[model samples]
Target: DTAVSQTPKYLVTQMGNDKSIKCEQNLGHDTMYWYKQDSKKFLKIMFSYNNKELIINETVPNRFSPKSPDKAHLNLHINSLELGDSAVYFCASSRGQGNTGELFFGEGSRLTVL
Candidate 1:
């Protein structure tokens, strides 16, 4: 079984439309994160949740929001999607809040906005 999974592996939508990606992990980890990988393959952290608590939030736009209902799930919701929002969103989980542990990443959800 996959340790981490994300729904709608590929998403295509028009600009100004809203979209969301759901993620879940079975590794029983306390920390989960949302990462965005741009076209240039530069990965950046958007949000981090530890034990269902928001821990680290990067400088992402207000249009992007990360919601964690519990320790095992983290969801990303985007409002008024734009062309610039097209990228691969990855869900990851680690053992703790720090960066010292190994992170397990999902297959990634690709979003395309026209």
Candidate 2:
């Protein structure tokens, strides 16, 4: 079974549009996170949730929002997409104390802002 899964492996959209991505994990993890890998390969954490509670939210634009329905799922919503938003969005999960295990990553959802 896949440890983590995110929908729409690829996304193409024009700037100013709104879109969202979904994610789920089957590892029974207590924590889930959204990370964006820029074109330069810089990985940055956008948000993290544990047991349906918001835990970490980096200095991401307010246009980006993350929601966790349960410990096993987290979704990202972006308003007014921008060219700078084009990047690979990754869904990850780890057990409690995050550092306890390596972050299990989804293949990644590539968002292309045209």
lDDT of 2 by residue, 1-114 (tens): 888999989999999999999999999999999999999999999998989998888988999989998889999999999999999999999989556378999989999999
Query: CA shift at 100, candidate 1, in angstroms?
Result: 3.9
Question: Candidate 1, residue 29: CA error in Å?
Answer: 0.2
Q: Candidate 1 local accuracy as lDDT?
A: 0.94
For candidate 1, lDDT tens digit of each residue in 20-78? Answer: 99999999999999999999999998999999999988988999989999999999999
Instruction: Estimate the overall C-alpha local distance difference test score of candidate 2.
Output: 0.93
Local distance difference test values of all predictions, in order: 0.94, 0.93
* Best model number under lDDT: 1
TM-score of 1: 0.97
* Inter-residue clash pairs, candidate 2: none
List candidate 2 stretches off by more than 4 Å: 98-100
On the 0 to 100 scale, the lDDT of residue 74 in model 2 is: 97
Model 2 lDDT-worst window of ten:
94-103
